[model samples]
Target: MKEINREVEAILRDMIEQRVRAMISGEATSNDLLGILLETNIRESQEGGIKNAMTTEDVIDECKLFYIAGHETTTVSLTWALILLSMHPEWQERAREEVLNLFGASKPDYDGLSQLKIVTMIMHEVMRLYPPVNFTERSAAAEVKLGEVTYPPGVHFLLPHIFLHRNPETWGPNANEFNPERFAQGVAKASVHGAFLPFSGGPRVCIGQNFAMLEAKLCLARILQHFRFELSPAYAHAPYTLVTMQPQFGAQIIIRRC
Candidate 1:
C-alpha cells in the first residue's frame, strides 16, 4: 500500500510539474482540468484544517487522487475493451460501423460520443465480463438477513463482480459469452438491479464514470477510424485480477491502417 501510494504521488507530482512548465513557457495560458482540480483541492484543504490554505502540497494530494482514480481506472477499461474487441471480430465490426455512422469522415466529439449507442453497448458488455475492480467488501453494521441466509453484525460480505456477472441464471444461457447485443436496450433490460455494476452502485458509484466513458468513446472512435485491429497470431488470452483485471500475458494485436 505504501508503494502504491508513493507511485501515485510520483505520477501526480509529474503531471503538476508538466502543467507548471507549460504555463511558464507560455505553451498553455489558461487553466485546464488539472487547474480546476487544484482549485477544488485548495478549497477543501482550507475547509479541513489549513488556515490560509491552498498550498502546493494540498494541490499535489488532490492530483494524486485524480491520477489514481482517473488514470488507472480508465486505462484498465480501455485495455479490457481492446482485448474483448480483438477476440470478437463481429462485435468489433459492429462497433466500428456504429462509430462511422455516427461521425463519419469527421473528428469525434462529445456530441458524437453521445450518439454511439452500439459502441456504448459494446463497452458495457466488455466491462461486465472484465470489470476493473472485480471484488469489493462491505461490513455489516447490524444483523441482516438476505433471503434464507442470516448475517450477524460486523460480518463482512464479499461481492465478486466477475462471479456475479457470469451467473447463468441472471444472465441468459450464454452468460459467459461476449455478446454486446444483450445490452442493446441498456443495462435495465440486460440484468437485475444488483446484478450488473461495473462502476458499482448507489452513493459509492464511481465519480468519474462520465469522464471515463467519454474518454473511451473518443479513443475507440479515433482508433477504429484510422486502423483495423485483430488479435495477433501469438496473442494469449489470460485475464487475472490484481488491483484491476488485466491480461496476464499482455495485449498483443495486429493493427492495419484503414
Candidate 2:
C-alpha cells in the first residue's frame, strides 16, 4: 500500500510539473480543467498556504485530490447514468424531455440545472446503483461502541457500499432494481437516515459532490439533445469495483442522431 501510494504521488507530481510548464510557455490552449486546478494549487502554495501553512508536498497532494476527486468519480457516475439510460428508453425519453423543457435550445447553466428535478433524480438513482467509491474504511482512533459491537482503538472497519445500497431492509423489496422514481422526490424522502450514501456521509462527505452533479447533468442533457441511445445487444451487465465501480466490459450502446 505504501509503495502504491508513493507511485501514485510521483505520477501526479510529474503531471502537475508538466502542466505548469505548458501554462508558463503558453503552449496550453485552455486553463478550464486540470490546468486551472494546477494553477490554483501553485498560487495557494505560493501564498504561504491556508491557516496551517500547506507545504509544497501538501499542494501536490491537493492537486492529486483535485484530479481524482474532481474527474474520476464524475466520469464513473456519467458512464453509469448513460448505461442505465440506454438500457431504459422510457426513462431516457423522460429525462431528455425534462431537459428540453427546462433548457430548450439554450445550454444548461447553474440556474437552469437547479430546475432539473428529474435529471437530478436519475443521477441520484445512478449513484445508488453504481457509486463511484464502492467501499471505504475507517480506523478507530480510540475505543468505540456501537449498537452491539465494541471496538478497541486501532481497529479497522470496512463499509461496503455496494451491499449497503442494495439492502432490502433499508431500500425495500426493489432495492436491486433500477427505479429512479424512488428518488423522484429526492433522497431525504426516499430512504432511511444513513441508508444511502453514494458520496458517503457526515463531515467527511465528498467535497466535489455539487460539482460532479452539475457536470453529469450538463453532459447528459447535451448528449440527449444530440442523440437518442439504447443498449446495444452486445452490452453485458457485469459491473465490478476496482478503484471505482465500473462495468468490467465497455458499455456498448446504439446511438442515433436526434
Candidate 3:
C-alpha cells in the first residue's frame, strides 16, 4: 500500500511537472483549466511581482486541488443525476421534453441550456439527495455561537451533507423523497433556512460550481436529445460511498435511442 501510494504520488508529480513545463515553454496549447492556469503563471512571472501571480508550487497545488475537488465530484454528481433520472421516468420524460422543446434534435446552445427550467429543477433535487461528497469538515478559529449551540475555539465540526439534506426538519416532510418541484421557484428559495449545500455554501463554496453545473447541464442535454435511459434488469439498487458516493455495483442503465 505504501509503495502504491508513493508510485501514485510520483506519477502525479511527473504529470504536474510536464504540464507546467509545457505551458511555460510554449510546447502545449490547451483551453482547459490547467492550460489557463499555467498561462497565467507564465505571464505573471514575466511581468514581475510575487503578488502578481501564483508561484509554480502554488500552481501545482491548484492542479492537485482541481483533480481532487473538480473532476471526481463533477463526474460523480453527473452519474448520480443520470441514475436518479433513469429510476424516475416521469422526471426523465419531462426533462427530455424540455430539452427537445428548446434544442429540438440539434446542438444545444448555451443560451437555450440556461433556459431549461425543468432540467434545472431535476438537477437540484438530485444534488440535494446525492451530493458527491457525503460530508465535509471545518475547524473553528475562535468560539462561535449560533442559536442554541455554541462551538468552542479550535473545535472541528463535521457537516454531513446527506443528513442535512434529507432531514424532515430542514426540508419538510418530503425531504427523503425525490421531488424536484421543491426547487421550482429557484435555489435561493428552495430551502427557506438555506439547508441545501450540494456544492456547499458561503465564501468557501466549491470553486468549480459554475463549471460543474454547465458541464452537467450540457451532458444531460446531449444525452436526452437522443437517448432515453432506464435501469436495466441486472442493476442492483445499492449506493455506497468511497471518496464520493457512487453505485456499490456499477450503474446498469439501459439506453434507447430517442
Per-residue C-alpha lDDT of model 1 across residues 1-258, encoded as one tens digit per residue = 899878877877787777656655657435667776655554566688676556666777666666667887778888888878988888888888988888887998888899899889988898899988788779999999999999999999889998889999999789999999899888898987579878888888889888888998898889888788888888788898777788888888888998
Q: CA lDDT of 233 in candidate 3? A: 89
Output the better candidate (1/3) by lDDT.
3
Error of 1 at 63 (Å): 3.2
Models ranked on TM-score: 3, 2, 1
Per-residue lDDT tens digits of candidate 2, residues 189-247?
Answer: 88786788888888889988888888998999999878898888999988988788888
Q: lDDT scores for all predictions?
A: 0.82, 0.84, 0.85
Displacement of residue 156 (Cα, Å) in model 1 is 3.4
Give the per-residue Cα lDDT of candidate 1 at 170.
93
- Give the backbone clash total of model 1: 0
**Candidate 2 segments exceeding 4 Å error:** 1-52
What's model 2's TM-score?
0.83
Report the C-alpha lDDT of model 3 over 1-258, residue by residue, as the tens digit. 799757766776687678876766768567877777767777787798667877656766676688889888888888888899988999999999999999998999889989999988988998899988888889999999869999999999889988988989878888889999999999988876778888888898888888888888999999999998998889887778898888889888888998
Stretches > 4 Å off in candidate 3: 1-5, 19-29, 45-57, 142-154
